[model samples]
Target: MISPVIQEEATGCGIASVANIVGKTYPEMKAIANGLGIYADDTALWSDTQYVRTLLKNEGIATSDNEIPFTTWDNLPDTALLAIKHHQEDGKDFWHWVVFKRIDGNAMVIDSAAYLDSNTRTDFGEMTPKWFIKVSLLHESSFDA
Candidate 1:
């Protein structure tokens, strides 16, 4: 099940996304990330896949990080943590973490950084996913192998 939307603070996108997937409050997850030495208080940056994987492990969830091409977007699971890259007006690739899921037959994205106060799903058509973390049960084996 997908968790409630949690707004990101500065570089909290990665932490917030991980929190949403693990059913933790943003502050709580931030604290955990900090204790794990993955959060940078000075810069408010938290973008470490290894740390994210450890967080999932602590929650009893098995996951694997993968770089997925856009052509395989349709193969993504209904609910997932996605990393999307888009070119900003500054002529640079801007990376953002977002939650991807389908609600009522419509694909949508829950981007805390985009709309903070609101917890609504937006159209995924505008997003360009570059990477994703695949979460699954411990006892299950991936079909990819």
Candidate 2:
């Protein structure tokens, strides 16, 4: 099982999520996020997807161009950034970020929530994902090569 990167701040799940996907430490990811003006204290991140997308882009990681409505775990891509614990507030959308990866027919979620005893969650029923951004790590040219 892949080790999870526990979020260092209450609102730093976004940073930790990025770190989890990119194999960076929480502090390391936080510094990079801060350098890009992406702060955890900003609640705007809860509703905005661009910040996380931008962070992934900076690391040359590609994600789906648009959000895809989540159906079932079996339908999810091999790797994706999922939006769970979704809710609407003041007419804006907010959701927690979690990473999903399926390998060898085994699927699991890497949640950055600091309070969770186990960051690697496999109980799919407990999570309700609203949508997902497919994370494609390989560059297109890699397929050509």
Best by TM-score: 2
C-alpha TM-scores of all predictions = 0.73, 0.93
lDDT, residue 10, candidate 1:
67
lDDT of 1 by residue, 1-145 (tens): 4556464466677677777777788888888877777673433243445666776676666776564544565777766667776435445444667777665666666676745554445646666777676776667776351
The Cα RMSD in angstroms, rounded to one decimal, for candidate 1 relative to the true structure is 3.8
RMSD of candidates 1 onward, in order: 3.8, 2.9
Candidate 1 matches the true fold with a TM-score of 0.73
In order of listing, the candidates' clash counts read: 0, 0
- What is the model-wide C-alpha lDDT for candidate 2? 0.88
Off by over 4 Å in 1: 1-3, 40-48, 86-94, 103-106, 114-119, 143-145
**Candidate 2 lDDT, 80-123, residue by residue in tens:** 89999999988888889999989798999999998888999999
